[model samples]
Target: MSTIILVIGYAISCTKNDQVIIPDAGASSTTLVSVNTSTPPTIDGSIDALWNSATKISITPTVPDPGNGLFTGYIGEQYAGTLRSMYDAQNIYFLLEVTDASQSTNVTPWYFDPTANVAGKTGWAKEPSSKTYDVNGNLIRAAWGEDKFAMLWNIDNSTPKFAAQTCYASCHVFTPYLDYSGVLASPQTATTPPTVSNSGSGNHYTNGPNEKIDMWWGRLGYITKDASLNLMDDNYQDYAGGQAITNLTGGNANGRHVDGIVPDGTKSTIWPYRPNYTVSPTQGEVGNTQNLKLDGTGASVAVPLWVIPNAGSANFILVSDTTSGKAKKVTAVSSAGVLTLSDGSTINPTVGTDYQRTGDAVNGPTAKNSIPANIAVPLIGGRADITCAATYTGTGWIIEYKRALKTGDVLKQDIDFSSLQDQVFGVAFWNKSNNQHGIQPNLTLTFKK
Candidate 1:
């Protein structure tokens, strides 16, 4: 975070204490719609009775804050987004939709620079690629960074006018601990910087250096961080830039911990989650229920091997030769024998992106085809308190997140949603894997019975 930039201007807080990020864009201030439904909305991103009728708040692009020196806004009016909010008596929900042209999940866990002889290096340009340099930086140097989203909630509404001036209260260029080698860079220091000089930058909470802001980070790395499970990470931004307290099942703080170059990296670190066709029978390809077309231009012909797990979940990954080890998630697992990949393509693992690995009788860590898919121990606690699901409809992605209104587990970093008071929150979206994100600050979610 030590990317020093000369601050050309400074921003003064002028927004009202009651401001809402998406107010009357045509819709009224009833942005937080409460629905007391006994039937929980399916965590599947589809427009259902659970969330379809809820008010859809249009999210416009957030212009760059010239006053903020770390300003890096890549979304230049290119994409627009929408959001939906709903809550039952026990939980709060948010569905965010963002327009993205492509999906990029090449996080540090999944990045492989084989020619340069590094196994789990990052996507940065410093990595050797036989002929060129891996330039995404030791921490990050990839144009196609991981796809992600985040939600920021004002803790205890402590900052004055947090309900209205949500994020602005904390944007004072306060850096969190990102030092990979410094002895002082412990997780505790990473969560709350020990001093003003070593904090690094970008954390703007000035009044109270220890002021906590609830931040939910949905990095694509987490989705496949585990070979068999799906996850989204949770962290908070305070004195330190951003720190995640826990990882999802099968998730880790840093995928490249084997080498300590990026030791400070969090689970949100840019890494890829390669596919493991051998883990379960129905894991990668389920008998090629539908036939797919292949590129047919490879030097060596590719093969597809259908596998089934011991007790596989309803989820499946789409392995394709064209996309290297990129695995797309296929939710519909019809037992009828015919497989429909996430794309409208058939299940015959011979299509452009319909490829699979085949080495051992079953695909696991030892499977020849999936030799690189290192299966590590999942995260502790798994942060089950926060659950989210998303579906991408061609132009954009629709995401749904659900969490209990009360925090009980100290391990999960759960929120204390106990009282009926209103809370302040902010949302951000990543488009097509760019490092820059579109952010909306100071959103209010009023909890009422």
Candidate 2:
């Protein structure tokens, strides 16, 4: 086993009646076993010297069963990675490095279309296609979203099934209505009873009430960055009465929710994380500055509420294909709904104003330059517990994360690692596709004492 040596020095304090003593620095040194360090590694994306002494566990992508719908028919190229972990007296740390080919940051950007007759032609563009089918003509793989990573851990061991099934413990697929050819039918509209026809394989929920799982979700580029730290969305999974057979909207059926306040203004209510937009338009007639602006002729016209005038190459990127792009930074947005960029240039708010030609998968011929729809902001409350630092190297990604072993979470939204017990956890990676992901389940984590 690898070991890390930590050098320590102490000075003796003495009163007038006591003697002062100085300890030799060489004799004061102590060696800490790998994975249990007296000094914690820095929470930066770069691999530090201390990491050399830690154990490296290989991480390979695994396909899920077709019935479960969690990457069932994925035919994409498989890539393997490595994982290393260490713990201090107060916090547990993780270092995950994955093998990826490209760096993808753009997520559903808005494109401008001038030829369209209707006003406000700017709309969200669909991602490029990269889907593959199997011999039976079943859709196997689809790519086009943002790069992401996630970890699911059994909280307090409340769900014993997680020890054996890992991520599969919470994945429950309801019965789907079939077609005439014995194939699964699409979800019908206005059905008498709610069904899982549109459930797309399954949803995540615990087996029983009060059971919980801690989910650490990290988006490679979409999440907020504080200094060098990229904050992961701290989330949890629990039972919510399973699929809603009565409600057609699938209300409260899926058990995955953020670790924050619920809808009834109650801290216990389960609510999805709302994006902190730079500017959200108020619902009203379009003439105001919020949603739509007034044209020179007093006609209601739609214009982008905010703009990053000269966002540098690193913060902002213009991509032609999925593999390559130019980079730029998204500095900040104007709260006052000002269209003037930092360079003193103002954008024309006319109905036919053209931004640029951004490539689109759906509207191929009229691809236009794309603008980001929203900016990344820090989440509040327990949802912000985990902080991460991630860097996308030319060939892969380096992600480092840290969180307290015991967070004083009154709602039990987090896993308690203070006991240093062997933890049952699973990991998944989404490489550009939102619905498809590669999972590594039934994994065990044993912290060094």
Top candidate on lDDT is: 2
The residue-by-residue lDDT of candidate 1 on 1-449, one tens digit each, is: 00000001122111122121322223234256454556667666566766766776665544333232232434232345667766767777767777776654432211112232222221111111111123542322324344567666666654554565555554433222234333333443344443323321232332443455555666543443333333344444343221232111121221101100111333333222211111111221123222222222212211222322211211223343214434332323222222344454434322221122223212111111111121222222423346766665655566667877775544223356667566766655554332344455645666435
Best by TM-score: 2
- Candidate 2 similarity to native, TM-score: 0.66
Ten consecutive residues with minimal summed lDDT in candidate 1? Answer: 1-10
lDDT of each: 0.39, 0.52
lDDT of 2 by residue, 207-235 (tens): 77778888887877654233432677777
